[model samples]
Target: EWQLALELLQRMPELGATADVISYNAAISACEKAGQWQMAVALLARMPKVGLNPNVISYNAAICACERGLQWESVLDLTRQMSAARVAMNTATHTAALMTFSSAGRWQEALSLGPGGSPRAADLGRSCGTLLMECEQRDLLAVEVSLTDRLSAAAREGRELPADLALVLDLSARLRRREQQPQELQGLFQALRRPRPQGGGRTWASLPYQRELQLLRHVLTEAPAGSAAAAAAAVDDFGAELGEAGSWAKFAGGSKAATLLAAVRGARLGDRVLEIGTYCGNSALRLAAALPGVRVTTLELDPLLVAIARSLLAFAGLAASVDVWTGPSKLLLPRLRPLRFSAIFVDRWGSQYDEDLALIQEHELLQQAGGVLVADNVLTTAAASFLWQVAHPPSNSFEGAFTSRMLAVREVAQSSEEDWMSVSVANFQADVFRQAPPIPPELLALQAASERLRERVIRSEAARLEKGAFTEHAKATLSGAGIAPLE
Candidate 1:
């Protein structure tokens, strides 16, 4: 249908046929939905040539296309032109501009729009949710994650967004990528309105905070003079503490992790953070710095690296907190009884992530309501293995009540050749089982079976070897021949 409209548009222009506003609007809308930002822009530019002055509708369509392209700057420029043309700002236009700036974490620009002393926060949650969906579809999420920052701001402002906002945002973004014939954004939004856990709980609602979350964390601990919002007002104070660092872009986790972490902290209160694989505290520093006053309990099995992290933390003066747990998570998580974290970040040094997550969940560490569990290396293997356990009769070794709320999961943008990196975030809302008694099966029986088989095969091979009297047979044969092959 859209293609037909565009064809009509092209033909009318070539054949000297009269083209009306209806045809132009239909064609422009089609181009916008096609993810054809360039074509949409080009067409809009030619509107004056066709003696049809671009109206608010045309400007809005171009802005929508620019937004999809993540060319928010272009969106801003078009938005200004709309005002210059004396076009009244509608809710959609204001919302689009607000969303663009919010997605970039440019809070100053986002907040400066409305007049009056008291400013109304546009539904930034809608944009946050929308941008996150874009992150998922584009396969390029490692770098852009400012949604959490906006999320925190919305929560603090007491903005009561529709329960189904995330769904609406996701579907709106998807309208470009794929077709959902019977179901459109309306149905999708309705589905998301179903109740769920609130994010940024003292105990997490879902997953890990990236490395640069320290920015938002810092505001939580202490606010500078003349601040309208303090860190305390920034997010739910889930007993989170803050740590600081100097540089994040130079960290081992890459600037993308730092950028996303900072966004999460800035947007929400992220505390009681956990780092599963703290490699010399490079990424740890980024998270510690963004969070205003949240102590991060980082886990690393290697002793040398643990020492290195400690030294780095001390140098950053964050050693007063940011405790380093120097052992396997399986051993440490259980002992820290009565545990509930706002976020659990996993970056285990090796690729045994499947087993490692199983071990962590088996301990029921973040098994409280509104806990977030984020695992790295999932873009390489981001699919949640324990999702089935949470959903049904429970799988081997995993015991939890929750559903995965994926936020962002993908590889770090290309840094150099010969290196690969990725991360996946899953939010979990914990529940208690009222079904048949919780199963007491092995944590990793599926893996255990293979070990047992390997052991059996090794033992059988040894027994077969022992039973063979090769020496005797060789001696007998040599005696019959009165000669030995080697002797």
Candidate 2:
């Protein structure tokens, strides 16, 4: 059909005529839609040869064609060419990058575009397993190790490590020890390794915890097992029932939301703590379970959410040390004494993530002496914007590399299944806003500068990796490493 379209074009229009943009676009689309991608690319070469020029729309259409064809290298080339010619990369260009990324199963790339919302780290770990399998099939060890590091980082930072990730870890260890075993032999090694259990059903029994467990059951029931009173507790509004342990439910599995939850049966932390978001009491329950040895005071913006979290706490049987209040921080924060907090986790109004961070800092609630603050979804612009605004010469990143890694994360022109859909398709539905980042002139420049430096460093590292010289010492990067552990 593409051949027919091209042949009929000149024949119908006087056998010899300069192609107009519309005529070119029509042929391009016809070739793209017909799956004749190489023909479409060949037709593009005709533009320069025939004295016809490519416009922004022409470049966009051509990129879209290359993108849809899964002609990745071609897509990248045309994209760069458009840039060299100063063609504007409107929303269409950016969107195509996302779409193309998805097609190739390059999920990280897909998720990084203009890029709001990251998948829960656990989901990324799951994808790492799938990618590892694909790499094994293709016998691509270099790509496999790179993907494994990404998986390991996500898992170490609280993404659930699936069996495959564990295998990757074991294999990575073996490879480091100079044993690059065959792919077909992975199962034997896996079977020899003791299986890791899912700590999904964490049991707790302190006074506050039991009651809150009961309340949580009422709110979200069909309890797992072995907790009768917990499974039997009431689920209606918590404030209404003075006896109810807790209420409210948020249906996130740390899958899409990028917030992973571990039901710690026995965990310990300092007495004074602050949390930024309280959707239901999912995190609150886990917090309460950790509080037998300490006190935890959390803040929330919604009374409904507060009530729900409160019930979960009451049901779980620990409500005294936990305070679930609903209101803006401006009003509530002033009430707390300065220098009163030991830890704070930020996970609220993404738009105001920066503001709340400042509040936490200025009020001295978080002392510089080992007061930990874990900010969620910093991968997104909404959170990054706030972070960038609040920066001094030094930034509040996890490490020196955050600014760059966040920006040049190798985005593509598509979203593929092993792609964008893999890490965060669901979260994207809830987040879905990618207009220009809310950047002021100064901060925008700062962000651009940070990204530029980051890109340069990454390029140098990639060069090293390519030269077969990228190596880690026998000790893990974990020991006083630049990256922090989630727990």
Candidate 3:
């Protein structure tokens, strides 16, 4: 239908017909209906060049297109143009702008719109609910509670809250009261957290990993400030009081601490927060403390670690504030849609960082504007590939969407050994950043082939081990035969 409408407009030119503002508006609307945001923008831009003046409706159509594409910066830019052209702003204009802010996770800005254009309390509540439902800050929750109170009072007096806002607040209150879980919201949580099949589990941390995390946390806290040498020596002191550091993910080290602090400091109260690697819930605790009543969701790959993290969180009286789920983030992130995060702390295995980020884009998980991505251990060689992707995003895509900064720190337990690390903070900005291009067919085929080969290798090893030939000699024999051993 939209295509036919567009074609009709184009055919008008062949019939010696001139397009008025209505024709352009109709064409733009057609493009919007077809989800052709770029075409809609192009048509709007072409209007003036063709000697037609763009009215408020023209600007609204373009802004709506940008909003559909989640091109928040473009939406804001067109709105500014509308003001410069002296076009009177209307309810539709304000609604479109607010919706853009909401989609991009610019909640603070959304809430700060000027007078004569502010949304109703119920409308504001709906947006706030979207922004703050998963957020931990009490103040934000208090705001919602207050709004709900007002709405309830209004209802008692025969006035009613908007249905959308009422539903959101109801669900939020239920979740807070332990009457519900996010995973229960099938549409929201994406999938159920089922038990993964038991296989030869991979062990990531040894004593060294634990010690490194502990040492890093210790140095960050007790290390003498302003003295590099003292900081170095504190790295050497493994027996220092564990304090708060002892409770965090043992392997996060100092960079993660810095990243968490940076993220929490930059995050507004009640902003939804995500931690990629919970390990033992150390950073999760810190995040909760940093912003009281702030909701924190942490993902761990191992179910065993998930149990441990939950136990620790319970012991710390933080179980209610931090929701720890078991499963790889790549798999779980897709399920966390319609619940965009305000900040994401990446402390997962360094090698998986790139793939994890790709999943984020695939899922549209991050809040588009002012959202932060804080990654730990950016200095490690293993992290180089991930670092490159963020620092040098593909041309015209995610290139200017994030402004990144790298902070230098030391490896956790390997502090005395001078194992340095880095924290990368990438803030989402209101700029044009294209989505990641699709995976090439060749790469997909290669990945499939690799998976098949890996499965074959695992099967052969399982058969060999099942035959009771699990001795060192058998291992050496497999190695000599170029067979991969199971970890």
Query: lDDT winner among the candidates?
Result: 3
Error of 3 at 439 (Å): 15
lDDT of 1 by residue, 222-289 (tens): 44322323322322121122212221121234434653474345332445777777755655666676
Residue by residue across 1-487, what tens digits does model 3's lDDT show?
A: 7788778888998999988899999999888867788888888889889898899888888778777788877877787777777886665566666567666766565555432244443243333333232233223655544544444333222222312222223433444445565345332112111211211232213111233333333544554323334443453344333333432224453554655676557754346788898775667766765666568899875432443455334434466788876444644676688677777888854446777887776676776756667776443323444544554333644453455554545545444322223333445443544443453443333334334433554354334242223223322332232222123
Error of 1 at 160 (Å): 60
Model-by-model lDDT, in order? 0.47, 0.45, 0.54
The TM-score leader among the candidates is 3
Q: What is the RMSD of candidate 2?
A: 22.2
- Residue 312, model 2: lDDT of 44
lDDT of 3 at 376: 68
Return the clash pairs for model 3, or none: 135-295, 136-293, 136-294, 136-295, 137-293, 137-294, 212-413, 213-250, 248-282
Better of 2 and 3 by TM-score: 3
Which of the two candidates, 1 or 3, achieves a greater TM-score against the reference? 3
Candidate 1 is scored at a TM of 0.33
Q: What shift in Å separates residue 400 of candidate 2 from its native position after superposition?
A: 9.6
**Which ranges in model 3 have alpha carbons more than 4 Å from their true place?**
1-250, 253-255, 268-270, 393-398, 417-487
lDDT digits (tens) for residues 1-487 of candidate 2 = 7777787666756866656777877887788767777877777777777678777677666767777677766776776777678765665555565456545656455433322124454344323333343343345667666655665554334224332233334434344333544552335333423433323332233111234333443444434222323422322233235313222122222222222222112112356667667656555555545446656666665332344455445435555557665444643565465535555656553345656755654565653444445454333212334444332222344221111111111111111101010011101111232222345554444334334434554344334232112112101211122222223
